[model samples]
Target: MSTAPLSAPRPSPPMPRRTGRLFALTGAVVGVIYGYDTGSISGALVFLSKDFDLTETEKGLVNSILVFGSILGALIGGKLADALGRRAAMLIVACSYAVFVALSAVAPNVEVLDAVRFLLGVAIGISIVAAPLYVAESTPARIRGASVAAYQVATVVGIVLTYFVNWGLSGGGHWRWMLGLSAIPAALVVIPLLRLPDTPRWYVLKGRTERAVEVMAATDPDADPHAEVAAVRAALTEESGGSVRSLLRKPYARAAVFVVGLGFFCQITGINAVTYYSPQIFEEMGFTGNGQNFLLPSFVELASLVAAVLAILIIDRLGRRVVLLTGIGTMAVMLAVLTVVFSAGKLHGATTWVGFAAILLFTAAFNFGFGSLIWVYASEAFPAQLRSTGASVMLTADLVANLVIAQFFPSLMAKAGAAATFAGLGVLALCALAFAAVTAPETKGRQLEEIQDYWSNGGRWPTAPEPGPVGAGPLGGSAASPASPS
Candidate 1:
């Protein structure tokens, strides 16, 4: 055997490029739909509370229960997506949530609202798991970051659009329409799901080698599909990838803890509270008066969108750890300031302007690192076999944390008052800062193959600086076939 191999075997073929862009676009649309739903409830809750005679606490829970379902859904959704094709599972969830979104409009009371929200949360959970993973797996290494950022851009766009929709529909009775409208986008996702091809990586895992090539061609029509398929097959063979069990193994468990823990911190830093209740938080900032004051708070969404764009641009350049640290650090300071501003019980004319400005700044900081990187980091932090499950576990925590904050925000605001409520958020932000400083690794510009060994090495930045793609070799370098084309 050794005597036969003095020279290398024939190189694999090349791949088409169209397949990558198509998959990336699909991811962007899914991101938009998910993001839209995340904020849609913010404006709809007011009307919903009235229609169902919900108490303040009930209304908050109604808003958050869906996120709780989303948590569990994220955990389970990943396993499902991995085991049963990301496309298939995402499509199923898409249909389920679209129906439920419409059904939510007819909910008889808070009880039904909770159920609908929970189901919808499940849908969003699935979207979270499938969308990011799809972009990461499907895109060419050259454009993976940009592709994933497109998803982020879509999410922010969805949020901004939701705010505008909320503003347009604002009143005592527009909540039903708000909740129901999510289905429209869900329906739209169906068209793409039907047309967009499945992931080639997933196909290879299923042993559909020929089909994987076909998908590779569709996704990257300009490149050599067979070569791409062969490279993917080689990568998969070497990866030793599979279901969720590998995630719990000792080696992976270490990385899983860091990634998931950071994810948890990302969720509980009071960002969701601000997103869900900016209008209310602003009111407490002593900017009372229903008309323009209420509308003014909505502008924070614009800040959030801007922050995401900035983060996308800088993430690869600045490195993940520093960005996370900076975001967490800034958020901590702002939350503390907000706490003082609220606790003091005095609102100068400038206080209102400063208050809204600070809130927007806070939104910016949160989005800059924690918001955008959470999805990207989560998707990349794990080995391929356990990628979905591990991400799901983390996102479940995220969504549940979202629920904890959202479910009790109004009550917390009522009981502790604004100062304490915001102070709590400040404390959480501090913890995130500490977490980032201690545990988070710089992942900017690293390739997936180089990423796996990162866990084995305890996430130390390599000193040798052997750069091929971005990070180390096992998961980093791109494989091109020489047999077919240049």
Candidate 2:
């Protein structure tokens, strides 16, 4: 009997390594959609509350349902993508979110809309984990830091765009328009995912040797796929059992702690708080000159993208710890200045703009360091088999923290005032600096499998592999793909 293609795998074609720009573009689109969906709510809620007769707490509740729902989605999305493949999984996530966002536009009242928004949050969470992990698993290590960073960059872009849309549409009281517009990007994702190949790492893990090869070929056009295929299969099959449970044992535990802790610390710095409430916070601080225009969010996005691009260029050379510590520490200083300015009751007009500039500078520094580095580190800290689960754990913590602050920021700004909030964030940034100084290890210039073994065994350097043939399969691919598994 003749075996079918799935049963009898074909040989992998010659697959060339793609340029960093392709990966960056792919990542940028995904990130921008993520940012837009999440940030659009900031403006959408204004009209939503009026249309639905939502109370202050009710409005917060509706807005926060998304974050709360995303927590579970982020955790599960990683495992789902790892098992089902990043390309397919992402398509599912995008479509699901598009439907949910569309549903949100037709809700009968605040109650139903809040529930739908929560569901949409779940979709957003799925995209967040899947997108970054996919980019990390697919990109080459040389540009992994930046490629994964495409998540942050895209996020800022999405935020900028969403705000622009909200600002434009707000005048017409077209709340539904803002909610409905997200479907465009969701639709945009469907096409790319169809074109995008599965993560090479996923194929190796599934023992789908031949498909893995073909997928890698599609990702890059010139390199021989056979050599890389053999290498990837060897790494997956040869590697030992590594999963979420294994990450907490012995040497790997340190890496886990650092990842989770830093992930926690990153959110605590009030980045999410600011992101979720940028416009509201500005208004509360008496920001008037910017005129609630798209210009503000667009500038923030520009600054963030520039920082992320710069970070992608220098991250490997500077080391993760150095970049994160430097950026967060600098952010703390800015936050301190912001605190003093706000506390002195000099927060309106020019002072507010100066505060906004301080915030933008902090955003740039963050993208240059922490924002860009988090996904890279998460993907790298885990091994071939455990990346998805590991990323899930870290991201769940991130999502939960995001929910907490997003739900509270407006109230915090109102009750505690800008001074206390900025002061509190400065403290969190300080904590992040100290944590990185102590626990983080360097992954600069290292190969993927080597880095895995090192993380699994306390940064023990792996014996360098000889430079093999271009089509040598995955001889050098593991953390090198546009998206790492984690």
Candidate 3:
């Protein structure tokens, strides 16, 4: 309840540098577990379906059940992160992952496996919210994009690695091994997290100024920690509270709409459909055998991994809006080509290669833009006080869109065929592109406090007033170039 102005100078402490990177890297490891859990099922489904004698609907349920759980997890994730702290919430999620993956491996029946995977989804759900938020809060604005993109990079790595694992075990159809080995990575995440402090922003929110300054000094060596703390406090002072309903009012409302829309479009444009059902799609396109199915998707995933790395390299330099618009536009074009190829009838000979190339390019384009930037945007969009609450809302919208695709994609493909499916997704890609063009803000190197100010100032990215003492001006004095028109 202390509302003391941050203008008073605080004691500065010498803390180690690059600790912020450690936090980002640790969050990326969690992304690895998330990716593994998501991709493992893609290869495992073929064998698991045979063993369980699952119908198409049942298979879709098994795939989507995890997303359903994630929706629940995401709904509560904001409160959990806010109350328990990001590091503690992640610890809980990591433990849940280990337990659920183990249960999933030993599940004696399909029903049990579904139940366990749903529980696993809850863990994944919380992670998607916590991991990026942690990285965003802990790292400096200079490398924030790359640092957060590391999570996406790690995600692609996990997917590619899981695909390889699936191919290795496919000879004997060892789906259990594919699903359970992720627990090892999940267990490893606890180590760095145990040593890492909660984000300075979180500390400031709780009114622990001394600790917040200490952590900020360590994480952002270039900035005056006292200034940063003052800015965060200034921004928080302007906000009423971090309630969900508050997001629907004034300055925050536009942000809420943009973030939720971004989250929904990020999923609904058919990335998960390809991710979850690549093998089946390939099989329908005339690829035969588990080896071909799994091997082919591995190549596609590898392209995504390469593109994710590219995102890390260029996101800060090129800015979020350019990457989002260009990547989404490319995806629409690729989907259009895919729709045409599939409509030519079941792929064979030359058309098969064309379809493969289209899918590969589509996946790569997606990873470059939507996959990497989604986290950055989600993490940076809201005021620090409402960061978790806003993220939870966006993530819930995201998972709901994901659930719809995962639950219905199989049936959609079966009833309408690949041509129509690709066509529908292509239209969505177009919509997402237009949405980004209109609404996405360029948050290239702006500090978190500056971003909060952008919302408060009626959507204009605030330019810094004349420089004063390091932390003198309102909202922590730092020169900032105006953002490009959103």
> Against the hidden reference, what TM-scores do the models get?
0.86, 0.87, 0.93
Per-residue C-alpha lDDT of model 3 across residues 1-486, encoded as one tens digit per residue = 565656975645355797898898889889988999999999888899999999977888889999999998998888889888999989999999888998898889999999999999998889999989999999999999999988999999899988899989999999999899998878878887788889999988888777898899899888899999988877777678889999998778888999999999999998998889988888888888647878898999999999889888899998888878888999999999999999898678999999999999999999999999989988999878899999999989999999989988888888998889999999999999988888888889988877865765566675656556654433443435545455
By lDDT, the better pick of 1 and 2 is 1
The numbered model that scores best in lDDT is: 3
Off by over 4 Å in 3: 1-15, 463-484
Each candidate's clash count: 22, 31, 0
- CA RMSD of each candidate after superposition: 6.9, 5.4, 3.8
What RMSD does model 3 have?
Answer: 3.8
Best-to-worst ranking by lDDT: 3, 1, 2
Once fitted onto the true fold, the runs of candidate 1 whose alpha carbons sit more than 4 angstroms away are 1-17, 217-235, 238-245, 461-486
- What would the per-residue lDDT of candidate 1 be over residues 156-235, giving only the tens digit for each residue? 78878777777778854477777778687787878877766568778777777777777767665666879877766665
Candidate 2 residues 12-115, lDDT tens each? 44444573345456667767777788887777887788877778888878778888888878878877887788777788887886788788888888878878
On lDDT, the stronger of 2 and 3 is 3
Off by over 4 Å in 2: 1-6, 9-24, 217-231, 238-242, 293-295, 346-350, 460-486
